[model samples]
Target chain A: MAINRLFRWITFSYLLFFSLASVASDELEELVEDLEYEIEDLIEQIDERNKRFKINGFLSAGASYSDSTVPLESTDLLDEVNFSPEAVLGLQLEFKLNDKSKVVTQLVGRGKTDFDIVAEWGYFAYKVTPALTFRAGRLRIPLFLLSDYLEVGYAYPWVRPSAEVYDLAELFSSQDGMDILYNFSVGSVDTQLQLGGGTLARTSPSYGGLTFKATDMITMAALANYKSWTLNANVATVDFVADITGTLLGDADNTFTSNGAGEIKFDHLDILYYSVGAAFDNGVWMFQAEAIDTAYENRPGPQIFPIQRAHYISIARRFNRVTPYFLFAQNRTVSASDRREADAILAQAGVSPFDLARVFTQLLDHTQSSWALGINYSLSPKAKLKFEWKLIGSTKGTVGDFEDFAAFTSILGGQDALDGTNVYNLVFDVVF
Target chain B: MINKINSLAITALLIASPTLVLADLVVVVHPDNSVSSITDADISRIFLKKTDSFPDKNKATPIDQKEGNPLRDAFYSKVTKKDAAQLNSYWSRLIFTGKGTPPKVVRNDKKVKSLISKNADHIGYIDSASVDDTVKVVFTLK
Candidate 1:
């Protein structure tokens, strides 16, 4: 009796909403679940086929060759120039609601390093009228063209996207949310207007407190893909909640220090994320590149500046399924040592002469640059292979630090040149 | 052995029977529809939610066969260059993520025929052999 009541309530609610909002005259969005078998039957008759769950993915393994003479702090590091293979396998179960919508769940296992149960994505949607559609649930942020299809390996011509643009932490961002996307034509270009915002809450040691409520984190993004030229822009702000135990206890001392006033000086960091890029893809050869940057701003002046700036350029050629591509990227960050470029700012704050001298010394030895190169080969619609090499260099910055640390600590100096390392990787990817 | 023979006989008869042939899926429109010819790409666009409208002025809505329907698979693959499993995963990424969905589906040939005949702005595909005088056939499965 309860089951019947629940079903009845759902039917009533569906009918109530359908009657008020439906534009297709039939108010048939609710028929999605009811028409599944018929869809399968028609498809079977026309194409002569049936349905079954499927599984597919790829494997990756790599190693690296680094210039050990350089310092890891300033440049990218590599212990050795060698080979290590990394592999991942993904399986998907798909349910078709009709020709337009489907329910799919994909599980991917990344070898070694990282493992977790991720929803990847899930939701329900439909278009009742040409001008309006409905979608609700956890979804991908369509800030970029690839945002909708980021996980499907065959969608792009790269083994792994360039870290410069792809690793911006803000682009692949997703959480529980809803959106309404409307399409209209501008002159000869077809455009889509996607307006959406959602709340993403996650708990980790990186943030203090109990990983509690941190809502109102807003994200707004848009994209324009006309012909071969595609451009995207997006902005989002996320607040970090207190994970005091993790931060304070995990610090050098497990106690909070105050200036004798019983008032705590805690760090609350908020990120201001923005990015824009454009690419051209018109069959044959394709040329693409993107520049992405993030500005980290803190509440107080004591906050650190990341000084991270990166971008990459790539070219690809597709001769049927055997498309080969090449990419190059360089990224760097300037650490805040209170003496790098704001010496006057710190000096004005009334710092002792001794600390000011120390700041100058710290500035002489900061990070320089990190970079990478890659090659990707698309073997087929379902599979591909990729090879990459990276070289990160730092001289004036790390050499001084290594020399100073060598002078202070005999152990690191007693060993060898306390500097850099290398890493190499290969990957196999696919879709089912 | 006798049972196997009987099953084969039934299967064979089912495939050859005219009664089981069903009806042609007409590419339809309102009787006063203005567009002339629609390329396969255009039809795919309409059904895949890539593009909407008759290129004249009428607002358009796509009608689909049910999910996992063999006919739906054939049509999608013919245009989208994707297999059945791939399409399933594609829609999952969209629908579950609340991005987009396929078209609303009609049950069988009879239901599709009725829906298309009643709505001029609606377009759908059915078995070519099932075409009748009551509906207009805009395109055929080549």
Candidate 2:
């Protein structure tokens, strides 16, 4: 920690000193002349010493609103609508090692949500020439154009993410392995083809007072993009500690076998997303959309988790200063066998978590739709302001939200999922 | 007093109306060049670093006014449909990667008019009202 701090200070002071020197001698003609030369020299040096490395990112700060007469409440007192203190921060570094190889890293830390390091990806790439390039490293699992920038937090259209598409994958879809990318051109249309596979590691857990080590994970994915159309598909099988009834074991790995408790299960998950993203200046009318489906095996205790299906569509119209958008998203994930099996396990476990099973059963019966109304104002190229109001009412009113709309509700038994209760947001974001 | 105020308002309108009219920059090539009219999409393709040459058989060396010029803003808004910051981000992605750089910016109208005059294959934009015999107007912002 001390060494890292010392290094940061040194780099910061060097940057600061040069900036001051540039500013302090601005008016003198001779000094200005020398400064220009110095600047040119320094830029050349940066080019020579640095291997095409570049830094970029964004930051956002905002609040939210609720339709209910009173503002909704949440745990952190951070994301409350009428007023609150929360900051959204993100940063990324791209190191261009050469024409064919590069490294990219990004970090997202938000104040409203617990601040932590999340979504780190790095890979080695080889250009098998301009038309054919191959890369083998952990990639952001190319599901969407926005997927690579998903966690950069400041790179999107919402204060928080759309949630519909952002949360499609339970854990990030990155894997440890190799991929091949081919960029080609036919007449006027640009085409890119990518095919590869990799083994995925379990994300190291460091939050929510409980830790989970994503265990024994492997994945394979294929995707292609021709101009505005994108096709993506991937599947993975992972080992997990099944939800046991009675004990509150801190670590699942050490206790899974010896405790005479829960069973170790293999979860095979398959996901497919096909999207057509197009941009046209139909006189400033822009649109983007993506459709997706997900399937889980053993969702109901390693045997019968049922097939959950969902799709989301979004459209946006831009008129100079204001961009308003409409979105419709849905999920149908109710399985009687899965719910009953979960209940039976919880009822027998004799643990405090049993109470959650009843709520899950109710949620299974309802939750027809999740949609949002949003407005984004491009006050300037450097700054943007966005307001989003989501309507997440359950088909069976008191079902999905744990009987709470105005106060904090534990929507997911996992404890990590956002309290999908009713909430709204006002976000001010910028990228420099 | 009302009469005086009206007179003053009329004078002000006369003074400001020309600037308010928003002169579109007509991006053009020298007259002998083969490419005639270009679509906003083609223009966007060139400016966004998606292509290195014009639709015709010409090597396109792009020229622009200073970074924050209103005419520049108007031109990009018409072609790319992305605001300035968005374009800046797009350019950065290309520039820092050595894939491309934004067109070299000229300081004023005279520089633009002269540069386009010198190269038949070059691409550039200047105030539409500022067009002359030296440059042929091709794509207009509006």
lDDT of 2: 0.54
- Mark the 10 consecutive residues where model 1 chain A has the least summed lDDT: A255-264
- For model 2, how big is the iRMS in angstroms? 10.4
The TM-score values for the models, in the order shown, are 0.59, 0.64
Which digits, one per residue and each the tens of the lDDT, describe model 2 over residues A46-69?
A: 544554776666677777654343
iRMSD for each candidate structure, in the order shown: 11.6, 10.4
Q: In model 2, where do residues sit more than 4 Å from their true spots?
A: A1-53, A65-86, A98-101, A112-114, A117-119, A123-128, A131-137, A152-155, A203-264, A267-283, A297-306, A341-368, A395-421, B1-38, B50-66, B85-142
TM-score of 2: 0.64
* Clash-forming residue pairs, model 2: A64-A81, A245-A349, A300-A305
Q: How much is the lDDT of residue A153 in candidate 1?
A: 49
Candidate 1 lDDT over B1-142, as tens digits, reads: 3454575695567456624543433465544566656666567556756556665546667778765455665666665555544455345444433345567667655556666677777877766654665456777664
How well does model 1 score by local distance difference test? 0.51
lDDT of each structure? 0.51, 0.54
